[model samples]
Target: MTTGTSKAGMMMELSHDSTLRELTTDQGVLRYHEAGDGQPLLMLHGSGPGVTGWRNFRGNLARFSEHFRCLVLEFPGFGVSDPADGHPMATATDAVGRFLDGLGLHQVDVIGNSMGGFVGTRFALDNPDRVRRLVTIGGMGRNFYSPGPGEGINLLMEFTENPTRERLVQWLYSMVYDPAMVTEELIEERWAQATEPDTLAAARRMYGKAAFAATAAAAARSEEAPLWAMLHGLRAKTLITWGRDDRVSPVDMSIVPMRTIPDVELHLFPNCGHWVMIEQKAAWESTVLAFLTRKDAA
Candidate 1:
């Protein structure tokens, strides 16, 4: 076996206590971290080079797991999941659909951050019956703009052997209110994931081509009119939460979606950034729990 596989095996062994499992889907066998028991809640992570479900939802897992079956999916080419043969973004929506089918979950509360948010919205639109409720955090793809130089540079450095920790911290700090929250352990974990031999090349390819291309294509198709129209058509109760200080997908972009959806509610947390769940875990959990447990939502 390759060094990457050996390292992954070790990581899996260490994470066994977390109830992590490998689930086969159409795209590939995905490594997922699952917890809790009740109504199903599917969590999708952002599309950062080395992003995973754990990194996106780590801080809020305990609270959410208490009330819902929380399944954090590691997308193909990210975390421990092997790369898909086709274009990753093109096949992702179908992969998610197959995953839900494989699990025999008719409907689920879908929560996604960043790129996952984009996919969640698309999935809801494509398979309304499969999504009971939709929640997106700092979502992208609604608008089409090139990733700034800083973002491009960060994506490139993530694949390097010695990814600059300081740069990574800076990038994360820009995504949250308190830079101090970017702990050493968190940084190290992110570094390790980014540098993992199995995923590094795939990550670079995603950043360079599939990610932005897919986002642009999706945005062009949705535009403002179509996206709003789709939001209006959604039967599921929707909750839109955004960070007041979100520099990535600004709070302004969320306003139209909140107003367009008939049964939608919006929450903008102050002193927060793109990663609101991590930046304001308590408030985020309470808000989500209250929304999901509402009479109309149930």
Candidate 2:
């Protein structure tokens, strides 16, 4: 792991190397990207086919690193990190806990995208005192108006079941308000990563038709309450950001957390979709930095 003792030192290191660091935990030897030096900020990525921590948050990391020590954690089963046993979400949630514990970081400010947001919220609820602030970008709430498994998700499931460049392109297009964002290079990169033997297998376990049905059936059988119902138990100061036109996890999903979390705020970005931080980069970063830096209201 590299540390930036001076501004120039930090910039030089970041500019030269994009290498990720590793931390050994009971879950596995988890991988992550670390930058800056200050209050710890744990960043988690979404659980989409071929998605990685770098791909999800690279745009905002530099700016965020300026003020906080940003750690973009690579969840298990995502190809970048060693895969762990169990359902993907359960393994992911456990991986987050193990990551923090491995780093000896008791408390941190967390920003999670989609599935990551769900994991972060679950962690915060289960261990309230360990989170100071929480920020989630879409996919963190229960669907109220929109149907479950939104449009983008259906496309994603299709891609996982039958890996294809065309299907990936379709899903990528659905992720944003503008189709222009899905560039050829992005498609090629995602296709290469998404179709890797083990990675593709992992994706199937999480999003394939049978896997989805099994997950739904398991949830139905479980007696425990869902994450949305546990929102009130999250003690961290929270900020929820969503793309007004999100097709994956629709904007309406934010409603439950908006009404429940004791200390919470929500921002809806126009002309954006599931990838809020990427589609609305500057504005999202500015808003998040302000929230992270601002003193609590007296």
Candidate 3:
């Protein structure tokens, strides 16, 4: 890792070399951020225009790193990491396996946000012995009371298709219950990354109208069961967190996992939105840290 500095709000006092690392796996060149040392804690980021592992979990790294070796895996197809062929979600799920194999980490504790939560759950189901514990922040399970493709998702698709500053702003605002959380610096940073031609193209592959139709069609043809149906098979002790006011992948979407996962706990933050970790940083970090450190019955 090369030492560097930048004004990205997420970087804060974090120097590049101390955190950023890369591994060349068969899947691709995987980029990640590592800090401290202990039992591995692999953090996965959500799928969004300009979303990176750093931006998604940087706030909680300092706290998490103190007790664990924090590895924030930047999934492929995101601009911060190498882009891959095929649907971004499938690429991300595959990247997790290669990332662990390349690093020689047999098991880890995982904290996943939104789409990351979905990916983590899939991984834990597929490799039960490899995940010691799991923490998910929104975007797991199927839609319950809320409408499918919630408000924030619509805004995200709009931004992906148009690539306009205005649309990005709209989508950013919808991510949190408090609009104040979407600052000019955040917008500027996200806009610069999100509009990159390659990044925009990747986003289109995941959120564009054509991509949505393709995803639905592919799902209809596949024989594999949905994540909700597979939750009961997960062996990891799980903590599911959600913002009561989330517009994208609303709180209702957490219902299935909360009920079906055999070893699970659910915590809902009032007045919070999709970005629960950011919108309720202190409380969330506290909650997760406690759960991760708790002793499991023999």
Candidate 4:
């Protein structure tokens, strides 16, 4: 385990036993974390500037690992993953698909959050036979309104300065309805990761990409979007989890898809925000376990 004070003097606590492996994809070396065993379950993180598999799935890893082979991937340009040559979002789905293939995983359950959710959905559409089931938490890739200046400005500021403990607490508070759930340790850990030299630069690069903004803008313009179309075509049993209080993606986005997809099931977590898995781990884990188990039995 690497332990030291980061550039911002925050004490970092990384997993000493967490093995890092690389998958040589056409894009580059894609780094990922793996734990436990059983049916394979690939976890994809959100689209935050500094988001990685650790940031999104840290809290629920153990619970899911008990039931499945959990593999968490750091998307290109995030965490330890190498950057892709083209647009970030455009290449992400392909990179992820190749990573799965490298694992010799022909079909696996995919659980994605936010941007990861969007990418996973697209991956399923493009390679339906490779995915056994799907779960999306506060996913994007729809024609929703863009973030306003307030949201954009805050994101820009986070790219420059290391997010203070207070700032992280505030961010989570805004994300979850119950502010009390924002623990001191949670805030500290996130602050530590966000301030790391490698992570900070990766975050800056993501934020600096004009392609990311353009892709998001373009995604917000059409009703019959790729994600929506993909949702309609998904053959795998699907679960859509949303934070009732999520301001980022909003729970309303799940309405149309839930109604349209016959195999899709939707769950709304009250008092939760964008990071539902982190904020409501117990409920989230139970829901996922039950769903995956039932599907396997069938």
Highest TM-score: which candidate?
2
Q: Write the per-residue lDDT of candidate 1 for residues 136-181, one digit (tens) a residue.
A: 7865324334343334234344434344666566666667777787
Tens digits of lDDT, candidate 2, 1-298: 3554565655556642464789987656999998877999999999877899989988787788889989999988888889877677888899988898999999999999999999999999999999999999999888889998899999999999888888999999999999889999899888888898888887888899999999889888999988899888889999999999999999989999999999999999999999999999999999999999999889
Q: lDDT tens string, model 4, 22-141?
A: 788766789887765788999988765345787678667656766677888888756468866554566678778788878888998999988788888888888889888899898543
Candidate 3 residues lying further than 4 Å off, grouped into runs, are 1-13
| Candidate 4, run of 10 with poorest lDDT | 7-16
Q: Candidate 2 regions off by >4 Å? A: 1-12
Enumerate residue pairs that collide in model 1.
none
- Give the alpha-carbon lDDT of every model: 0.70, 0.89, 0.87, 0.71
For candidate 2, the per-residue lDDT at 79 reads 89
TM-scores for all candidates: the values are: 0.80, 0.95, 0.94, 0.78
The lDDT leader among the candidates is 2
Candidate 2 to truth, TM: 0.95
Where does candidate 1 stray beyond 4 Å? 1-16, 140-166, 209-229
TM-score of 4: 0.78
Tell me the spans in candidate 4 whose CA falls farther than 4 Å from its real position: 1-16, 140-172, 181-213, 216-225, 295-298
Better of 1 and 2 by lDDT: 2
